[model samples]
Target chain A: MKRVEGLTHSYRFSWFALILAALGSGVLLLIVAPLAALVLSTSFGELSQAAADAQVIQSIRLTLSAALTATLISTVAGIPLSYVLARKEFFGKTALLAIIDLPIIIPHSAAGIALLTVIGRRSLLGSVTGGLMGSAAGIAVAMAFVSVPFLINAARAGFLAVPERLEKVGRSLGASPWRVFFTVSLPMAWRDIVSGMILMWARGISEFGAVIIIAYHPMTTPVMVFQRFNDYGLAYARSVAVLLIIICVAIFVVVRFLARPTQEAQDA
Target chain B: MLELRSLSKQLGLFTIADLNLRLNHGEYFVLLGPSGVGKTVLIEMVAGFITPDAGRILCEGQDITNSPPEARDFAVVYQDYALFPHLAVAANIAYGLRARGVQSKQAAARVRALAEKLNIAALLNRRVGGLSGGEQQRVALARALAPRPRLLLLDEPLAAVDIGLRARLRHELRCIHQQTGTTFLHVTHDPDDALYLADRVGVMLEGSIRQVATPQELFRAPSDAAVAEFLGMRNIMTVDSASEGVCQVGRVEIHAALADESTSYVWIKPEEILLSRQPFDSSARNQFRCVVAGWENSGPLLAVRISSGDLTLTALVTYESFSELGIDAGTELYCTFKSSAVHCF
Candidate 1:
């Protein structure tokens, strides 16, 4: 019976099946190889030149600053909203959650257009704010609008994972509502919120379509990458892309490693 | 002193209505009941976690019905210990003090003192999540007690601990209460917690306090049939009064004290009933010939179910007596208990 089973399984692995599997894997490798080649081929001097470009520098700085600012805003505002969503029950709560997550499913350019309609000079908020249509604030708002749902959802899951009993105990210990949030809930949900922030920040930094429509002049890193590829050739674009990738990868690796150790220790 | 006057709350399907309780200062009061009896809800109301919809919670003479938990000056220890996972033992203990605007040094000092008292000094720097069940419980207790709240509420604090650790924790809790003179309103379903730790016990059922009495009184004499059954009274038998001192169960007339002048339900603890293989003479006024309907082992005790005519009674006996009497289903035996043991309600 064992021999027959092995023979039948072996027979299923035809040459065509093997070839298909190899081809699939090879395609993925091929897609990733340009990124690898960019990293390998670019020297420090080329990276410096790319970094020295006035537009490139401005875009990189703008991207980091906007992404960081958006992340901070989300962290401050999103954590409480997430906690409320996780812990409270009220009418329209499910609908509210769905609305918060709507941007992730829609097209980025469409999201940008929708944002433009709401915050453009012709719109009510834009008129109230005296023309915030194509400024840095508009870009930040647009990036934040599209990326904030990830943070809120992740933070909500984190808050949900924390037992309600902990907060009750904190209250019973004479800690006020605010104290309990800081002392128990926030700390317990910190890792999830942090990871969520990282994702949101990354999302904000890479945003192209929405940001381009809203504030094309500000030129976030992804928009800059697109522009470089258009104005120059693949080599210059790849060099800048390579620099961005290296910086992001280094940051991602360090943070992930630090978080990984703590998670494992906590699990143990 | 803490008082809950007609305290009521509605949570979806469960409602605690018209619950009135009073806990004197420095008293250890245990609210005992079955699960879902709303004992925890009552305690939570007093602790200021849940507001009573139609009641007044008075601390000393002050009405604190609408007070937030921070303003209530009451601390609670939950069954799960609810220790802050991110805070160190010391930090958790200090949290209450810090929240109430205590100076950092004072909070630290208080934490140190509390840690020492709770015997968690060595664990002061360790995160609460790293501690064992007993250690976490101590930290929770320390945190709750450090603030010196007017009333201390413990909602089955030892319920989640292993059985082996329960007795020790209960003892430590009692000791802590004694040392602090803190008014403790403890909620528990376990009879042992009531018996061991409470100065007084309130037996609750269906969101109401059925009977509130001393632990001994609760065990020896419950206020009603429901209270008796709740306190593990098993030897209940219906009887017709023949005279002032005599009651008839089937064909047998047993002498029992006619304390209450009404048609009453009789309750006796299973352990109070004595089993004999043959007719034996004793001070117990009530004695009847019964057939052993069945027998089962309950931990170290043998639970013998006996039937006298149509009346059935349960008796808890030693394992040795069970074997020596050769007690089994269909064994004929005499069951007797003291007249004083019969509680009529």
Candidate 2:
């Protein structure tokens, strides 16, 4: 009787696993199938030609530079705010968190419009700083406005994972608050902050509606792809899209490799 | 030496009010209490991690109440050790020295000396993540002692270790206190930790220090019922009335050498009560013919609960005597103790 029961149990386990695999493959294929088709459809000659094109190269450079700028600025400003959110409780804390998440929730074009009212020509900040419209700075601002929440939230989670007792021990050891932050808190949370920066940079690189509405002349890669698809058709645009995806993936892989925690950090 | 004068803090739902304590230099003082008595808050206040709402903390006659934790020359070894997970054991030991602007070469020497003394020399190069609980504790001790602070605050440093390791660590803590000559203020809820480690123990209750004395004194004479109860004397009985040195408890009368007219409760350590099958001709002033109500094996001793009329008493006896007396539920026995063993408050 026990043998028969065990057999039936094994049979049920296999059946459940098979169902899970089948359902999982549907979502996996939905993502991989299109990406595979896009890469395969573009010939090597077309990919090389698109990569060598001066306009395509310039747009990619602009996209990389603007996204890098946005990511750097966000990392510098967001880490302190993230640590505060992780370690403190105060009035309006929930509301402040909602505000931080607003960029991710709002439509991209609306985010762009919101950016314009502050930094566009004839606005208060714009008049003080001269116009930012049609400039790379405007593209960076728009990308940052939409993507910064990723970095803040991720870093906040990183800081949250660190036990407050560790920081207290650091301080009691005669290390100042700032020293404790740099040596204890930052190193422990380093992996999460790095991952958050990568996510923010990737999100900024893929921004289109915000960048287009804010700066059209200094065309980013996504904006150029959209314009090329509208003006020259899918074949021409597919080559550029393929090149961008390849470059982004390669850089992502390299950064991920470089960002892995050291032996000591892994122990942490 | 350290002193806290009228230290008070209002934490959520709990308040540590008008707490005052004094610590002599080069002594191992333990703040012993049950859990959730705000012991951690008081320790943190002394360590300068949590600021007291009202009071002054004096170190060598200098007020340091408003100083940041870094400015206070005190180190803490938390219950979980809180070793820096991102650093090697050597690095963790050298951290406080590095913060104090000590050169790497000098700091490395101090770290090695500490590791050698703590018997963690083999673990210097290893990361803290995979260390045994006892090893982590030694590393934490080394790190805290690196800068040689005036006082060391240990918040239940042995609470996480296994029972055997805890005993060994307790011995090591005493050795370190004597070797370093650093005033140690260790806090714990476990009375065993207090009994095994402390040169002097303070009984904390309701967020205040109720009594402070040597461990023997705290055991022999607790200031109040709360102190006696916390000290593992479970035989506290309410007195109906007290006159001179005798008190009435239920139908049985207890003669206490320490009882006075104002006494409302009488207490005796379970081990002080003797259990026997026959009455003995001895110096015991209090005696009762009790029926064994229940008994439990408590390690090497047997804890027997007995009833005499309407009053119950817990008496601890050696297993040898337990079997000799044939104590079990409904077994008639005589329990006796000297009048001096019964404390009244």
Candidate 3:
């Protein structure tokens, strides 16, 4: 009986495995093919030239710094909001969730217009803060405006995965509400929150339409690529894109390497 | 000591209305109920997670109706154990102590002491995610006990444990209650938890506590039909009429010492009845020539259903006697029980 069952199981497994591999490799090819073509189109000399160009270097730096600042600010503010959304059921919760997802749903250029209405020059918030137009602060705001949903949604999912009973138990053990949040809830959800921040930072680095409208002078890498494509040609633009992609990929790999050990230990 | 005075709460369609209970200090009290009976909600209220709509929660004569869960100092061990996956077993145990601002050295010492007491010393350095259910339970217990809370509320602590380990865990819980002398308010749907671990058992039906008594008293005498049925008393028969010390069950008249004018039903403990092939003379007030209707294997005891006239009674006979009598369907048997064994309510 066992031998017969094993034969049937292996027969079914082979077919399932073949289909799974085919579907998985299809996705892999779709993602990798364009990136590989883009990278291969630019020679090593051209990549080095773009890396050495002071304008390209400045834009990359500005992009990284602005994205990092936006991510840090969003993380500080979004975590609490995410936790609340995950744990609490209040009036307007669905509306609040929809509002959080608005940036993702709307066009990036329209999102830029909305941010300008809120914090650009002559707006109430802008007048209060002495305006953020054509400034690094404006660039960070545009990046944050377009990319914050990823962080909020991921953190919310993480917080939601944590059992409410654990928090209740933590409180019953004499921990204050704040203590429970920091010691129990925050630690449990840290991995998802960190990954969310990474995604937000990556999205912010590649932001173009919103940043172009808000602060084009302190150009991010994506805006610089567009500017160079219009002013110069496709070859120059492609080299800079290659440089940005390499830097982003390198940073992503390093971050993933740093995060892998704790995840592996937990899984083991 | 803890006291709940006319506690009431409206949670959607379920209403815990004007409920009252008092727990003596150092007593192991178990609340037995069916699932969705608002048992967890009641304890959560006592733990200060849910505020009672109108009630006074007095702990050792101090009112704490509105205290936060932390301020109430009542630790809860949830059904799932809910051990922190991010922490090691030792860290999990030390959580309460750290929350109470205990010094690190002292907290570590306390954690070690709890681990030793719970026989989980070896697992202290291991992560909680990989621990078995039993190990997680011990760790949760250690964590709840670390700060020495005045009351420990256990919400179905044994429900998730394997059946083979439940008995041992129940014994351990009894021992821990004795050693700590903390008022334990354990809620569970499993009757074994109440029978084995409770100093006093409260039977909850719907949202209200129907009766509270010692384990023996609860088994021997339940206050209502709901409570009796909840305790697995399957031989309850409606009393058509009662006079003096006798009650009419269908067309059969049975002698019960406790049957009164207001007695609506009479319940006989299955184990208390004796089954014999021949009519053996006994001092029992109730004796009937019954036919063996059906039999079911119930561990060491054979649950033999006997029908006498229109009345049917369940009797638990040892496997030895059952096979000796060679009883089967339609086999003639004489079942006997004393009037003292019958309880009417």
Candidate 4:
């Protein structure tokens, strides 16, 4: 009986199904071919040489740490703002939402310039921040400026998913508003907020245009790649690019392994 | 004791205007209304979540209308239960205690004790998302009752529980209310929920309290036509004339014991009307000759709809009586009722 059913199903679908699967594979190859070729083109000896270089290692460390710092700062400051945007309605709420989304749409170089005007020693905020131009702090500031929208928007969507009734129950149970936020809203939004943090961090580390414009002297990994390509050639930059991609892929795989929704049934 | 005096708010076209009510300490009061009649809004107001546009809420004879919900010493169980999805059953139950600075060991002990009482001890470590509707409701009750709150508010608590478990949960709620001795103000749209649990019920419609009485009183003697219509009363008519203890309604004179010159309407319930093949002697003063307009089986009994002149009256009869009298639609019958059963308003 099963064999008969299978024959009837595949007779109707076999060729069409094969062609559909081939189309999907073609798209996958379109994305995978360049990265595979980039890695394959670099001889192992060359990869080792790039790996051994002290400057390359230091730049990698600097990039990862700065990205993490930027992500941390965004989370601490953005979660509350995200919650407010999710729950409250007042004057100019739509305008505020649009403004929060502006960083993601504006050109990275323009974003770098905007950051500079506010933190370039000549401006009031620049003096307050001790003139962060061409410094690691400036690099982090540029990266955060370009990437914070991802964190805020993701966290806001997470907060919006938590029902208002849950929060009201918390308050009715003799919990203060602050307690309700900490215990009820924040924990419920944890998964989305954490994923957003990871995305923001990944986006921050890849920031070449904005960081190079704002703080080139610090020589983050992306800036170093550009410099190596200019001084030497394609062979030099390709290896570093491959190394950065490997590190990003490794970290993201671990994060995804941790974040995949558990099979356990969730509460209503 | 709790009192709401002139509680008023405008929610975009629907208005809760001048709602005044009082509940004695330890009273189980129900605010009954249909869905979207602003029942939940009133519960929120009493819980101090929303500040009323005009009113004063008094608890223990002190005004607390402006107090925040946290300071009100009240607990609420929502229709959806709203158990924290991230927390385990024990943690959800212990949340109120922990928020109030209860010690870890003490809170854990109290959570366990409450879980035991609610028959959910085995589920203390289970995640809320994995529980069934009945289990979630039990957890919600345990959570709200853990802190021994001064006042408990229930918003259609049995809405999510299945029919099989509703009666059991309702009995448990009554037991819990007695054990805790806390004032309970439960709001529900279910007639059975109110009748089973409420010591006194306030019928609310269009954001106003129409009448406040016991379940029997509210069913037997509703104050107005609207209340009668809401409670499923059908034998209502305008009184053309009212004199000493008698009112002429739709060309039939109904002997209403409470009738006076001021009365303008009369309400008669279906269960109070008796059906028979012939008129017999009885203390019931009001009797009418009616035709069997319709008959419907309501489980063990039958609801017989009878029409007399222009007035329609519903009378209920047992299955035995229905068979003994050979009653059916289009049969002539005599409907008898007490004059006291005729409510005049």
Candidate 5:
């Protein structure tokens, strides 16, 4: 058998592999135990009851739809930003990238407060949006605020991986700039863009601190889980959490299966 | 027909200054240079990707220096053969047609015709990402020709293809040019490519066109030292003395009725130097005794490096000649050549 890079071989298995396996299992258990325990703690009866609750169903629908909305809006706006960031060189590019990442680095509650200051009822933007507080739009704004960086970064990487020569070839083939973007750049980078959208959507659906502060009344699934935990204790929250995990996992798997390999990945 | 007049660009650390070149209709004009000579910048400038700071571009007698790439109506094949990974071969070829508002059926027909001409018809339905380097090159060529632009620019198109396939592709490119009758401006570093494909060959160095001529003229009569060296001439000698129609070069006196005066650089092509075992009568003006200091196999020929006293020169000898003369290192030989073969600049 051939030896892989970064792996040292002995009789059958390498010492590096053996140690990695042993050490990785500990971290794996630390993450998987909590999720497994949550699922195990919830009975089928409790899960069905939680699923049947009107507030639970409403929050689930609200969460998925808000996430979808935020992802769609980000896809439309973030793709251009990512494409420019990937292809253009300008003063303050690094600073712009850092600013895009500010929401992720800052505490989620702090991020929510920042959004409120911009789009709250008393502000100019709040009036323009008919006041964002406690509205579905507020929830989306909060979700987008915390999740857009993931989309931008992923899409930027995708665009960067695409050879600039391809775009030039398109131009030389008599394609207008906009036409080239739509026909060549977008399709070539779609796999990464789709992956980015999925990541943003997943992150948005799970958002709690930001969404709760912006729109607590119209609770998303995560916010509802928190409400259930605060009002009825751990048991109700655990069941809701288990159900949400199953839904998110199913969607994630389906999306991943549908995505074709990117050009860079295929070349590698 | 295309012309670039006094074009200039200052791209950090490199500059292309006052570069001028012209292409006749249906001509294969090759800009041959070593890598990093800013050949790409010149091509991009003509393609309208890089606007020249100080010159005008003319195509078919129209001044189009400020036109965008799409409006320029010129196609290009990049070095990497940048086929669209998202599209199949047919779709990639059809892209230019679709962009120009050609009907779908017409575009498909054009795509199929180009694919067949490029011998890529069987691979038309396959995704471009899965193609080999040569196949991708053909797909890119097909795409560039699908629109039938007035001129085509190829930037080191064979630079990424397999070496073994290059000679055959070179022949195919010449055939394609004849069949299409489109003007082509191909940039490459390979002298063989220029000699084989160009109707006119231009040597570029340091961001400027050093010389341009028909392949035969350029090979036999390079206008400058750079052009001569670029054309693979290695027997460059300095003048030690001068007379009415004679100049002392290396250890031998050269008699040339056509030699230029007021010249410091003298060059002779390596293949032009004749190697003989004994002094023979010939009309050649320069003949001298030299010892073979070293030899290297160059396909069917051997590149022999010889030195007479302080002067060293390289000469090409066929394997048969090398064997018949029993030539090896330290062997004495007589090298003869017409001094008219010496190009002065």
Candidate 6:
């Protein structure tokens, strides 16, 4: 009886272990498949050529510049709004938070259409501004509009987690409100702010539906890939797509490496 | 000296109506209360974080009612020891000095001197996040005290500390208060804090100072029933004044000195009631034959709940007294307490 009980217990433990291993392996497979395929199919020479292609290079530069601009705008404008939403209490605060998060829940294509209706040439705002269409400025605005909520919400959560007592202490120490924000609140929430910015930049970079509706001529990398697939074929498109993927992966790796130590220290 | 005259504020459901207080220079004044009694709000008003609806705050006869926190020249220490996590211990200590535009050399010197005084010199370069709770508290005190504000407002500084460390930190805080001679307006919910630290204690209830007196006075003779109950008075009995120096309680004529003509209630400290196995006593005005209804053994003291006729009173006795008097449930004993120990209200 003891032997039988031991065998049954061992079987249960083995089954549990097996289930976990299988789920973990499946997740790993799903993640690695596309990257492995990209690497395997493209030769180094083909990658180098694709990297040097003028259209690919232009698209990459545009994507990076536009994403960076959006990130800067989001950081500057989103942080203060996030702080307000996080800390202070006023009338209509819940409604205001909902309004900030509206873009995230809406369909991206609808967001694009909404932007076009407001800022496109035929619209009243567009007519007043006189043609923001097909320009770098228009792309940045559209990307920022769709991507800023992520940054703001992330920053708000971060700022909310910081104890209000810390700021009170700062005030009691004779630091002005502005001084407290800059010295204490800002630094404590910096990790979250940076992570939010990164997420915003990533979202902005990948944005194709909104950018296509507002400004298709400038062609960010994602839009360029779509255009290439339509103009030529999947083979030509794959090379450029693979190149963009590599660039994104490298950037992500660098950012993660730089941010990891600070995160660990914060945890400690 | 600090004075708050007719301070009033209404925040949501809580309100403070015309609260007033005065603290002398170098005196440690403690505000004692239960939670949500506007103690924190009062401290905040004094610290200049929250402006009062109508009032004038004066420091040494200077009106600072409308002054900003930075210009108010007062420091506050919160219960949570709100040290900036991003700064090192030394930098945290030097923050107020730096804000005042003191030179770096002078700030460093001040930080070192204060850190040494607080016994936190060894933790100077360590980050605030790395320090223990007691260490963090000392660092916070060092930082707040380094600038030497005219008044220091402490909002329950020892509330967040561990139980064992609380006594040590209380001693340290008392020492700091003495060494610096800074006027401290401390807020707390613990009577022991008021007893050990404050030169005078103010009991606050519902946004009002019910009574302000020395710890001994507050404990021995609270102003009213609520204040007495708050100060841990366990035995409160209704008494009909029969004569000049006598009162009737449950068919027993207890001798009590009537200080007020309209006195209707009497309060006695639990520890003031003496328990004797034999019926022998001297001039302890009130004496009754009581049976021990129940007893609770609190560490180092036995709390005996005694019933005399229809009236019950709790008395605290030493473990030795409990054993020597053979006190237990249903044990008949004689209870006597001095008339002066009975506070009439």
DockQ per model, Cα: 0.46, 0.61, 0.57, 0.54, 0.54, 0.55
Candidate 3 docking quality: incorrect, acceptable, medium or high: medium
- Stronger candidate by TM-score (1 vs 2): 2
| Between candidates 2 and 5, the DockQ winner | 2
Q: Could you arrange the candidates by lDDT from highest to lowest?
A: 2, 3, 4, 5, 6, 1
At residue A86, candidate 6 shows an lDDT of 95
- For model 4, give the RMSD to the true fold: 4.6
Model 4, A10-120: lDDT tens digits are 687677789999999999999999989998998888888889999988889989999999999999999999999999999999999999889889899888888888988
Model 4 off-target regions past 4 Å?
A1-5, A11-26, A121-124, A127-130, A263-268, B242-247, B253-345
Worst 10 residues of 3 chain A by lDDT: A259-268
Could you tell me how far off, in angstroms, the CA of residue B323 lies in candidate 5 after the best superposition? 16
Each candidate: fraction of true contacts kept? 0.67, 0.86, 0.82, 0.84, 0.77, 0.63
Residues B1-345, model 6: lDDT tens digits: 999999999987678988889999899999999888888888888888889999899988999998888888899998887888778899999989988889999999999989888889999998776788899899989989888898899999999988999999999999999999999999999999999998999999888899999998887677877877787667887766555666676687767776455667787888899988877759888888899999997777988999998688999998877888887789999999988887776
Residue runs of model 6 more than 4 Å from their true location after superposition: A1-11, A14-31, A261-268, B238-251, B255-304, B315-345
lDDT of 4 by residue, B223-318 (tens): 888887877666788889998799998788999999999888888777899888899999999888889988998877798888998778777789
Candidate 2 on B1-345: residue-level lDDT in tens?
899999889998568889889999899999998888898888899888888999899999999998999899899999999998988999999999999999999999999999999999999999998999889989999999999998999998988888998888888888888899999999999988888888999888998889999988887667877788877778899889889879988777888988888888787889999988889889889988899999998888888999898778899899888888887799998889999998776
Alpha-carbon TM-score of each model against the true structure: 0.84, 0.89, 0.87, 0.86, 0.87, 0.88
lDDT of 6 at A89: 93
RMSD of 1: 5.2
Indicate the docking level reached by candidate 5: medium
* Number of the predicted model whose TM-score against the real structure is largest: 2
TM-score of chain A, every prediction, order shown: 0.84, 0.94, 0.89, 0.91, 0.92, 0.90
Q: Could you tell me the lDDT of residue B41 within candidate 6? A: 89
Better of 2 and 6 by DockQ: 2
